[model samples]
Target: MIRGCGRLLTMRTAHRVETVRAAEAALMTRLPEGALMQRAAAGLAAACFSLLGKGRVYGARVVLLVGSGDNGGDALYAGARLARRGAGVTAVLLGDRAHEGGLAALRAAGGRVEADDPFAPLATADLVLDGITGIGGRGGLRPDAVPVARAARGSDAVVVAVDLPSGVDADTGEVTGEALRADVTVTFGTYKPGLLVDPARSYAGALRLVDIGLGDELPGVPDLEALQHQDVARLLPVPGAESDKYRRGVVGVVAGSARYPGAAVLAVEGALRGGAGAVRYVGGAADAVIAAHPETLVHPGPPDRAGRVQAWVVGPGLGDEPGVAEVLASDVPVLVDADGLRGLDPALVRARSAPTVLTPHAGEAAALLDATREEVEAGRLAAVRELAGRYGATVLLKGSTTLVCGAGAAGAVRVNPTGTGWLATAGSGDVLSGLAGSLLAAGLRPVDAASCAAYLHGLAARRASEGRGPVTAGEVAGTLGEAWRDVRAGE
Candidate 1:
């Protein structure tokens, strides 16, 4: 994990498989047959050298898990370079067919291939280069090589994966079965979507992009992207001296029920901390909301007469019929979540001209898509895209890796890089709904509002969990101010 959200991380843009392949082909045509591979090998070798730590490359034990295809060739070539530098390198082929040229290169450089007990070198290796399967691999590790893959992962040796981790889906980030975990992955040309998303992202400890001059050939519009601190800071709503309560932004809260007023309170907490100038409450839990936040402007009845609010955050504990339809009729941006998602008509949601943002967990998303939760979780990318198109709304699929996508296929999806499992506490999504709604009220587009909110929400959760203790929804909401400061501080 990269830790804090406000720190400067290189803006990571990931492209689709077809896009990457086209770029690779374009670049390959201009370069010599082995030119790109050699460049990738050199970069991979240099990365492994730094990770070797105390031992000199002159005598360090380097083990390569060579599989079929160019992935194996890349590792074999890198291993050959390491061997030439006096490192004791060994290649363990997982399949019958290995890269012939690469095998010859390794042998010529005094590197040897292991015929048996390949796992032995992994246990005591200074570095392990995983070439098991590359970006094109599907499913998981082959049954025969699973044990060796496990051995390399469990070893004290520094693990560096070539291109991508063997079993991760390059386009979707889904991990189907047994996969190799890499401490650092040296990818050529560009970042695949899987490297930036969870499930597959968790397997890749740290990501290192090794450019092989495919930038010019790649598509201008990337498939996925992650916002850095500067980008978020630029999007945040900053109030000037002349700003007033209404001028800054007013976010209406239409949430909570008789049984779950606490959801209203949590949502209110996040709204208060959000950039919005004032929060207007228009739900059944006005008394409970006012008790927790006396400063809130409370209004009874439905959101139809909630004065003037720039944006409305509906759902949370509002149940199936919390006057959500009436609220959506307004010309302001609305964010729908929780029980509000139940029995929602896609046509009704799309009929509103205003921007609509949907914050749905895997289960809620599955329900909306009329699919199983397992199906949604397994192919989150597809589920989120389908939901976004179906409802004509910016969908934020909340989970381990929060994914934000605009209403249609052309809009580039954003994968949130912040957050922890500790953030899975109750009422957290309610807080997120409020925060994102506040951003929407503050004049940000639905995509910006949702992505920025997820960033801040995750940052707050991380700050709250500093002591490694369990965090509550309030704790996460409480840290939003500090998170906001951190974002602007970088400016």
Candidate 2:
């Protein structure tokens, strides 16, 4: 198994490439270029055949979208391998100078150069190999390639992108123009950034990285990371026999109001389910909080009087209450969310002595950064990191793919893979804040707590829904126990 498959699986494509390059450099001294390409071709052919089930390769029409770079070569060579097995493979050249050796190899193996009209062959092929671009390609699909990409999208055949979806930026996960949406992306050597980050990620579905035997050369650290089940399990706070409520940690929650008391209930539910030793609730909705989870210690007073909490979860349904200022002012690891983020002073957040974590959806994040919602959405990584640096806190920007970044931790942004679009429903974020706050109280660092909670929260949401339909905030909290078990079991 890969040394850290569980952990490394979450790393950005650039880091994976570094590993690939290092491995290649060490092994290149012994292996020829043709040998490496053969290995890659073998792997790609095997994967494609597996996807094809029991279907015979002979007489199966395959279309290859060839480009100028080696990505096109991978496709062409793979086309040769398939042709040898009796498949009718056709290469559609997209660039002027195609990979000469690969094109010759394909022709020698009986693969033909079909009509260059990109759209025609796509309508009938059993499978389509998108070799228009690779990790080296920048920007979106070339103008001539867009209509062809659309035609492929409309087809029923499985679309396999070589390396990554063409036109998607490899390093930044940005899509400049039209990109091919592949059913499976057969990436060579290692993963690219576009495969993990959104907009670009959406295009590269079911990614599989083919090893060209480049393993020994990667760098020590990656640019971005994704946490796996085992990683989260190892990082989770498990109390010992001697651990007491005080020792385990206390989380003070300042949330809700008379108007939206349900937010308080959900937040408290999240905190209790989050494995905190004790959850102290301080806000106007103490009655409602108590009614929901009597286990929570409710205090009907200012946040300052909440009495000794290791961490604080503020702003869930706070409704512009004056006491929220007091909660924000406290010298504790704080998680600011929801209404607590509205019209807040950045200077006050910066003045805090303790670590702070801001959890914001797109709109809330936009408001805090003084940028339009579209700007934040366009540059999620830049927006979150900017907020973390400006406030000297941890920022957990919540969306389809949540991002966790520390103010000063260089190259330490963590992208969450566990969440689903179904989590976009109301009151889900409050549960997240509570769960994150509970972990913070239980002694995990701000980024760790936030990211771990997000991973679990998303997993729980997934479990609760079971792919059927919408789930309630309460269902998410209720499913945390099973999620925790699955994480512990290393599932």
Q: Quote the positional error of residue 405 for candidate 1 in Å.
A: 0.6
For model 1, residues 279-341, the per-residue Cα lDDT tens digits are 999888889999999999999866878799999999999864466888889999999999888
The C-alpha TM-scores of every prediction are 0.95, 0.93
lDDT measured at residue 382 in model 2 versus the true structure, 0 to 100: 78
What is the C-alpha local distance difference test score of candidate 1?
Answer: 0.89
Worst 10 residues of 1 by lDDT: 1-10
Q: Any residue pairs clashing in model 2, and if so which?
A: 13-191, 19-218, 22-217, 23-217, 58-86
Worst 10 residues of 2 by lDDT: 1-10
lDDT of each: 0.89, 0.83
What's the lDDT for residue 341 in model 1? 88
In the range 56-152, model 2's lDDT, one tens digit per residue, is: 6778889998888878888999999999988889888888778888999999999999764666777788999898986767778888878878887
Q: Which candidate gets the maximum lDDT versus the true structure? A: 1
